[model samples]
Target chain A: MNNMKTIFLCLAILIFLVGGVSNAGTYLDSAHGNSTYGVDRTSTTQYATGHCAHCHEQHASIGGDEPSPDSPAGPDDYLLFSDNHTSQTVNFCFGCHRGTVGGYQTGGLVNRSYSYRAGGWTSDTLDNILQAFTYGPPASTTSSSHKLDDIKTFITGKWGYTANSNPCIACHNPHAVQGDPANSASSAKSSGTRGYPVSLPSDHADKYVWDVYGDDAGEKMSNYVYQAPYRSGSTSIYEPDGSTTTTDGTNLTDYVTLCTDCHHYSPTPVSTRLGNTNLRDIDWAASVHGGKASWSKTDADERKLPYKAEEKNYVLACTDCHEPHGSPNYCYLIRKEVNGATTAVAADTNTDWDTLCTRCHTYTHESNSCINCHYHGALHESNPNQPLF
Target chain B: MKKSLIYIVSIIFFIVLCSQVNAEVAGNCANCHTMHNSQSGSDMATYGGTSGNNPCLTRGDCIGCHAYDTSGTDNVVNIDGSLVPQVWHNGTKDLAAGNFKYIASNDNDRKGHNVAAIDPEDTAAMFGTNGAPGAENALGITAANFSCAGKYGCHGDRAVTDEIISVKGAHHADDGTIDGMSTGTSYRFLKGVLGLENTNTPWQNISPTDHNEYKGINGPDTTSSTTTPANATISGLCGECHGYYHGTNTTETGGTTSPWIRHPTDFSLPSIGEYASYTTYSIVAPVARTDVSAVSDTVNPGGTTDDIVMCLSCHGAHATNFYKLMRWEYDSTTLATALEGCNVCHTSKN
Candidate 1:
């Protein structure tokens, strides 16, 4: 990233434009002019991270794309100064954290598009790079109704904004948003309790007593096994209530919603929807690996989920199976059949069944690795072949 | 004396007629020409006696004279400005199966011709189109190493007709030109025709400098020139069939905001680039082509983009039909789908 530092540097230059080249009205340092774009969801347009003046000048635009000439500049629609026209547009995000002079720890998220120049990047593979940004209901592609009304609406939803809020200012102070001082890893985030510093809420009301980042976790956290819950081989933790104790706060191991404040819990049951099918709710409750906390406590075979090893076992969020951002692999593939053929693209085979299966179960050293051993279905006899392309 | 002479003459006459019919492609006047003007029940013809397949010639002639080209040599020498390809049978011509060019054979692959499909019911025969509607329904779409994507099992109806073609010779019209005036006007025009941005309207000739060569090589000219008709037709042929691909500029609808678009920018299809999609929208940027970068001083000064693509770019349309219209990169039907296509333009250097 020769330009990794350029990301942070762009923001510093914006400080002078906010008001003056002084440290008074700017976001981090007042150089350009004063800006109030870092305010919360409830704050006024001038002082919140969710404000308009955050990323745009309303008059002196920044990026290549410009608004129509006849369009008035008063209350800029969507608060965006201009459209992000370049193919390397992720730089707009990197211009802050991955910029010069101040980021490393938080500058890790790679804009997969800018870096990986191919056809499409699988959402799962690319997620490895965008770890810091929290997402809304993913692409909602799974027969579920989690559809994002539109892109910005989709973006705002995931970044902790209502459907009708301003998105530009949510992460930038236009005056100070230049890829300079504002781009520092530390500067990217406004002082907040959230993992990301782009936008934080006032009163932080979304920080309710529910799961994610707040209260409902007190009961589940009691059984917290530091590293890998089941890895250390220590089985001492238990609740006052027995195994069947239900949400009465009994014997629940994986009940803890550490990051639930930003992400909501699923209302679905944990038994029926295991095959990574149409899981409506956000929580991974009914998934094949959902009840594992308790299941692993009993059956060893319950650990079939790849990326599920306790030495690997950790908080299995919606991200484990799917990426929140868009993916090149059709269906945002955790895995898929090559060319829609029988063979898998990356894993042992191309089938989502194979990839998802091998994610947990061991395979051939035979082909349909799962079918090789366990007699699952007709897949047993199908002479599995890879695609030519 | 009268009876005897009559008998002898009639027998000789019958003998001569039989000999002539046998010498030809074994068909009755209908072998080379279509009669009754019917696109109906007769796949080849109503009373057609035939071999399993045929090339550019009739099936009867194919099996009659040239069943298998044992000569192991290429005797085809196209005379300049000729309407047909010159097939030299002077022992110099190679006794080989012709690619799906002048000779439309039963060989399974061709760049523009992707119609054969896997018969879900059989899997033995490459399910063809000369069957019933139900059979057509069963023949799913499949990419027979025709495209570089290897993923487009792209089977759409021809010109808005739902009649799926599981067997085809040329999907694009002859020679990429649209009727005439347009170069890449085969389908929707390479850069969008009926849609909003139709830039390829005024198609350019191979060399804008001269109009003579352009007109002469307008059709499938086997003639050797500074730029052959085959070469000129390659891009048009590709763009014609691959209408939506060449130069595309996409705008995501009502999303937070769709990317901007003024002039159509190049967005490589998965077929051209090392296609990969991490997320729904996470596409890897398109890489530049190695071949174009080599001789590209004018079009792409520093060689940033891959200008040459499609069939003719790699395979000389005249010299090949083997390995599916491939000019180079031949192994067999199997290998052609793999590394062959990709390696053609990707020079070993970078």
Candidate 2:
């Protein structure tokens, strides 16, 4: 009796160490059997017996002990109950995650669809994930959809991603979500792959994880922290007067490091593959928009910027004037359009140039009459002797 | 025998007439000289002179002799009561050539040249002030002073110091003709001064023809093209006092090109443009004569014979009411009429 008690205690300890057994409430578990196809169809598994049975079976069952007792099922490829129509890796996830599945109907999980609005899918049922992942116009066209198989091939071929890896699993870990929801107040949902140690073919080992600490317990987790690979090196923070202070390790919250990881050195190939990819980090360090003192508070006062600050130490971040996931205007410009008539033409009076400039410099007159002070432009344009403007 | 006697008498009369015509100081010897150096028991030489025991035998020093009396008239009187041209007159009269009287009464250094004894060296002008470009200090004329006659002075030998010594022979042997006279050849006894002569006696109330003609040049398109007509010009005389301001070369003033450089002195005005309209000389912006032969008997040369730019075109030879010795109030001139100081030549710029 003592030995039996000891064996039971040891088994319990082993189970706890290796993670507990999958149960009904879990993502892989089901409450009802697969044969019953009604509103209470709560199973993600096809056989409704165990977790492995959700995707595969030991042998094809015929008449007895089968959930679908009336149906003949002597053969199925890969031990799957149904045929794989789409060659995409994400299609497997889409089958149950789609609203037509048993999990959503039973109010077990939210229904998510990749079908775009133009394909007769209502905007109400669509998620932003689908919008960002979908490559097509507001429609569910097959050709326009980004195939996971193709992406997997391309990433492996171009970026040297491991051949065996699936594009969906590369960024998302399905089993264990790493972040603690209690510690964060961010609106952005944490990815399950957050703490996964990912080894790149390149020299660096990127652990896709947050530097969790007690000090940051109640702070909102930034989206940039999740996306950027953890890099260990000195990163310089610039001051308003072009001076810099170097700190050990990259600031995970900074967009400069986060966006430049894949974009900086590998721009030429990426730009060739995806047109209109703005590798902005290349220009950001020296640009006036980035942090350089191109505009001043005096200039701002002249233009009448409403929220004028006492100190001229303000610097702009990438998100200040741009939307990351596209906006209605071209280049995802946040406030005003920049394309306008050239400086010489008198007809440029109606251009939005002033409106764009006045985003910071608000007091400058929004007209095409710059001739009094900027006389060189007009003089150069008029004088044939002076070819330069 | 009667014809010979008549010829001899005529020859003697001609010699006496020539002697009087050449005389600059024609008066009784006693009026200017005192051999004993004593008069009425007082030492005349030591009593009234800049230096003690005045050996030149003059009444006073250069300043004293030329300065006006308390009643504002000439201090020195000739035997015939004809007064010499006083260089330093009181402000009650505006003399022909200009006077140093304004310097003392106004106490304005810019009112006159700040000659020694008449006034102190021009403190404001030594390093230049009031927008006027400075004189070339490299030439060792950091301060302006005057001598009676020498290179540094204005009369007979500009380099000499003692006025009576340098111009001693000139006073007694001066002939008032452009060609025949050696001493007074430099128009108004300025020694080597070259200019066209006019008929204003004692130098006052000058008209275009009555004014002293300044030497200048016609054109080879630009003033800087040739160096032939430089040193003898009236502008060159002013350049001796203010050296860096002479050239038509733009680089000298840290500028770019011709005409745009320092104003083109001694350069001919273009006859085809707005300059042609200035046929009647404006007294405010007078040009000089490039051809000295063009001046004859007339007291007013009517047309464009005076179209060449000279130093005096923008400035007065003597004192004026304007700053920088400018002939007119350049700042007060307006752009509306285009008939102002600079606009008189730069017609289209406004």
Candidate 3:
């Protein structure tokens, strides 16, 4: 009877082990999975549907057929079927993301001509997004933009990303994209989904959403809660109702917080960062646009903003005046006009007081009438002893 | 006979009073004239080594009558043992208005005005260390020239050259008070000139209180919106030539800012802060009179009207031994001495 009990216990343990593997594979098969890459005959094959021949070969494959031109072999390192050079990481994403493939819409192209990437794009949209990546020829001396060939260099050197990675996979999960659907409201575009903590590498727990609702009972309480893609030093999961829970997993909808993940962690000082890196979290704190004093002076309903009733409070977000992706104007300003002026002002042009200041001031004064009340215009000229009229 | 004697006594007394009032050109007429225009057949009209039929029935021209004799004595007409003051002289004593001999002696160009026949035409560069700054003269005059009692000279006609036309009807007038009116009321025969003046003669040993009183205003316009005042002051009189440096007008000052774009003149010294500490009047940077009626010949002249900043605070009417006709050596003075010179007014800078 004791030998019979031992056989039954071993058989039950094997069944439990198989059940755990199936559950893990099901989680990875969610809609956020990378359907284009990393497919092979393995225990996790049941979760993926893409063919493995697209990226790998079991034995020696044809020479010079690698996806990237810089790859050392036909089947590059780790049988990536592409070049493993750091510069070719973006090119790999470009394959499926650029226009339709196999008569099916693969993904959006970066150029403005395509409809997939056309939600709210302008002529300079791609150039603005490319500003964060460092993979192009060296810019001329006159160019004011930042440039680096390796996206991983910025991740490791400035953003403290220790794991080897590419830009898209670094911020997005190829398997399970886990976050509340409501969190998509904060993206630069509504089409993009929120990021999930599981997408990050195992060693990158410190980069996950935590204390997002400030409900952490320990010393890990966060000063401010942020939306997904943006990370703080919190371990708590985000919730939909603006509250946090230890048992359930959800994400907040404050998309500007996601941008802070890379921006706020720069190794260089905010004052010295190239291309105005301090605009979002740092400069916004001290700027007049960020302060509530000017906004509080007027009724909230009387404000001239273009937000919904629920989002029309005096407290402004960075997106109120700036477009995250790109804009025709330099610095990605939302509107090309300033003050009350009719003309669209360039970044280098002088401020037009009528168009810009009267937006909130609401008074109809002449453009050159600053000296009527202030001591700024021409000098006094009449005789002092003359009778005043 | 008794009434005739009384009339003669009255006439003599009136002449003596006239002599005392017009002391600058007093005494008998013979001292400046020759009746026959000949003395021992050497024509008296040819005196002073000049050739001309002497006009005004006088022995010499304007220069000769105003200059000193070879004996180094001033050409003065004495009467009743009273030595009347001469307008021009080369004696050791210098008058309140400096003598023209300095310019006549071929000395430095700055010694005196380059009056015709006394000195050559001014050939010096404009805006020199000793000349007026180009910004200070709104008339755009690039060089300095001289004429007798006319446009370029010191009498009423500021736009004419004839000596008789400029000094017309000014010599005989005996009024000594400068009531900001007629030539008789003008101080030092500056006909039609507007300003306050010290009526007291023998203009020497002048103290801060005993000096010439200048007309000014109560205070500057706080808004900095006005320029010239309706009434003229001593600074306005100087502005007749140096127009740019006087008023707060942008046109005059060539600036776009005001109650002043340049240093302010005829404005009151504020009675607050460091200015209140000035209990005593400074001879170096003397204040002027905003209300001429309030003036008194006393030390430490006190009143709100007595605290005005005037052009005379930094300049002298006649020539001085310093550059730009400044009353003091501005370059040599240090800022630490706040109690003297510019620091007296610019107290905080010290």
- Give the runs in model 1 whose Cα sits over 4 Å from its true position: A1-54, A58-75, A83-163, A166-279, A282-288, A291-315, A333-352, A363-389, B1-350
Model 2 CA deviation exceeding 4 Å by range = A1-389, B1-23, B30-56, B70-82, B91-93, B122-144, B179-183, B218-230, B248-250, B253-257, B293-305, B330-350
Instruction: Report the number of the highest-TM-score candidate.
Output: 2
Across A40-82, the per-residue lDDT of candidate 2 in tens digits comes to 2233322222233343322222111223211233223333333
Task: Give me the overall lDDT of model 3.
Answer: 0.40
Residue B231, candidate 2: Cα error in Å is: 3.5
Alpha carbon lDDT of residue B125, candidate 3? Answer: 44
Docking category for candidate 3?
incorrect
- DockQ metric for all predictions: 0.00, 0.00, 0.00
| Candidate 1 local lDDT, B1-350, one digit each (tens) | 99999999999999986664331223243433344324465444221243333433333321122222323232332212211112213243221112323233343333323322211222223223312111212223233422211122222222222221221222223422333222233222221111111122211111212111111111111211111122223332333332211222122112112122221112222222222211111001112232321211122212223332233333332224444334333433222122233333321101
Per-model CA lDDT versus the true structure: 0.27, 0.39, 0.40
Q: What TM value does chain B of candidate 2 have?
A: 0.72
* Tens-digit lDDT string for candidate 1 (A251-349): 222323422322332323222223533233443232223322422332234444223344322333322233233333334333221111122323233
Model 2 chain B weakest 10-residue run by lDDT? B220-229
**Model 3 chain B poorest ten-residue lDDT run:** B221-230
